[model samples]
Target: MLASLLDSMADSLVCSVELEKTKGITVRVYNESGKLTQTVILDGKSITIKSQGEQKSSTIIQKEDSIISEVKGSEQTSTITQKEDSVVIKCKSFQVDAETVSVKSSKDSTHESGGKLTVTSQKDMSLTSSAKAALKSTQAMDLETNANLTAKATQNVSLSGLNAELKGTTKASVASDTAVEVTGVKVDVKGKAQLTLEGAITSVGENITTVKGQLVKVEGALVKLG
Candidate 1:
């Protein structure tokens, strides 16, 4: 049996130069120059591949069946997006490009969705102390981060009635120091027309309101308002 197996193997190689694999098989690819190209494994159903130059397994997709609203359909939705620092997934369409990546579900428009956008540095190199010591490499973007507008789902929009509560956390850090400084600004709206500021009120006609007010001047500024 061992001699026959080796003979079969020799015959198979003589037949075709390209590698042949079946399900539940593992295959590794090498470039013509003998560089590692990719490694793939078939786990009875799906094929997973780790490509060259990629940090992680580059691609993994599974095929399955699904049952929808009293009917059965092919379970055909899976997406992964890795932008600069964020990842988002929506539906059937999923794309990972240079800056922002998103995955969308084509089944339902308003169903569950996930999305992430990276608004910071795009450097691909990781910053390590030893690596930096060997080669003078500047530090990458600090982890300390903050977003200007952060809000949870609100029940309704406040036109001119009561104030809505907005809550979030913040962290601030420059460079070289691990300690972080945090600050927050809140615009609390409590009563009807209670919160008002006098910067430069620009409007079409006479803008007057009987409430807490400040001196109004709009003559010398570059832009004027009524």
Candidate 2:
């Protein structure tokens, strides 16, 4: 019935409505050139709509379990799929504005940004990895904490740089279980008030040792000079 109706209006502007017992109902529109420009199908299980333009096209399909919408142009294509459990969107660029948003993946997920990526949380933010995690920056990276910052490792922690300095406003301490050694071409240990060196055995200056003070006194159980 629909084929005969379409054949009757082949060269004219045609708008047809077909209702079939087995296939379902269909509505179609054709241009004067007999080119199909629009189509709509409504069945027991699904509904589909399609529109065609000179340089762009759009299609929408709605089913019992899913709905898909797609648009195509010369430069870009966009598609959206909505299912019972999930929703997926594909396009050239995407942006979202919401009070809260959450994303989860069962297996693995990856996100790539060509330009800059920034994440901001007003309250708190946390990231956890089951195995290992690494952070790298090509140019430079900066980390600042307003409150307190803590880092812990089970095995060992190492810090290396071309030049490194450690400072404390109130006090500073270096403690180890076995031994502590400071090696440099020249080392300076100074105290504003008093300086004390205590150990089981104290040894200073391999090549030469110098003691300078206004009043110098050497006190030991037995003082020996060579």
Candidate 3:
């Protein structure tokens, strides 16, 4: 049987099988260049198979109900297709270190982390969604930008909090197409150097209006005070 199997192979291929008292059986195949191309070791409990190509090497070990396989190469690609059910991998720790990695799903995909999960990019990162995207946090969420940060919406942009504040170191301006209203239990507007309120029509209405300054000057075409 072994001779017939060896005769079936190509002339450039050499096959040999060795039996050991303690190690069981080992079968090795050599290529034309006398390089070990394939090896199969079968013991009573497990079977290990290894294959080497010009640039790649693969090993598969099968024991009982579990099988482990590994492949190493400079440039390699792998494809797996499952007809039914799903494929699951469970381990104590799993990691992949590569120059680039990409994952694509036809329908929907989910990623869950028990502990902390972090993603970092050296250059730039962008996220786009066709419908809607939402982010929620139980505690607090913070967003900081070194250069600039911009938030734009087609319909409307709403921001609400228990306390909200907007500040600019140099200048800050608020413009509206129709009207701008500021209402609260108490409203305070102060300018460090000078304050200017200019509009086509400026109306100030309150229960009591008080104007006090070091030097009060009201310059207008017609100034009326009650």
Candidate 4:
């Protein structure tokens, strides 16, 4: 008895679909060229728009501003649509071959890719914002080139925060007639120390002691000479 009831319900569902097809709304348009010639409505959720020639039919979820959106089939193609305050765009593959391209988001925008992303410019590329802009990654940050990297400011340029570190194979140059100050609770130097200048130019204000492992070699005074 249960099997018979299930079979009857399946038949009813098939009949309802056939009735919907037969009783679908068809609107024929007169003097319509390069537009939808007929619009078929089976229910509120789906609609079909028919064109003239080889671009015959397309089933869309919504239609607005001469665009059919959320087309039903394998690989869909569509344009823009608006639902309330938000606007959306859908397509298979889009291409624009023009002289220039520009995209701006009023608020914040986000982009994610499972593959790779590449950006190339012929000349210079500058990024500026009124607020802060930050970029961070989980693994590592790499800077590779034989070129020079410079940071300059009108007032101050400082490498500060916890313990500052510098790792370079070449030499580090400092400006002439400028000050180089190193202050800490205990300054430790692991390698050999070398100091070279024109005359007696550096002032320590305290004492500078030179030690070799366990023995102290010399203790000297620093004279401030301008």
Top candidate (TM-score): 2
Q: Over the stretch 27-108, how does candidate 3's per-residue lDDT look in tens digits? A: 9998866454899999878898988887888887787766667666766533222224554444455689998899998888
Q: For this target, which candidate reaches the highest lDDT against the unseen true structure?
A: 2
In model 2, the runs with Cα more than 4 Å from the true position are 1-15, 18-26, 29-38, 41-48, 51-57, 61-68, 72-77, 81-88, 96-102, 191-194
Off by over 4 Å in 4: 1-57, 61-68, 75-80, 83-85, 90-96, 112-116, 158-170, 176-178, 184-208, 211-226
lDDT of 4 by residue, 1-226 (tens): 9999987665441111223455666554532234334444555444655433334445454544343454434445566666666777777665789898898989888887656766668777777878866767766667564577865666766555455677667765555466656667887544457643344644333665443455434335743333
Residue pairs in clash, model 3: none
- lDDT per residue, candidate 2, 1-226, as tens digits? 9998898667676789999988799999878563448989998779999998777889999999999999999999999999999899999988889988888889889998888888888887899998999998878778789887778898989988889888878988899899788988778899999999988787766667788999988889988765
Clashing pairs in 4: none
lDDT of each: 0.44, 0.87, 0.79, 0.55
* Positional deviation of residue 207's Cα in model 4 after best superposition, in angstroms: 6.4
TM for every model, in the order presented, reads 0.22, 0.65, 0.62, 0.51
| Cα RMSD of predicted structure 4 | 12.4
Q: Which scores better on TM-score, 1 or 4?
A: 4
lDDT score of residue 141 within candidate 2: 76
Ranking by TM-score: 2, 3, 4, 1
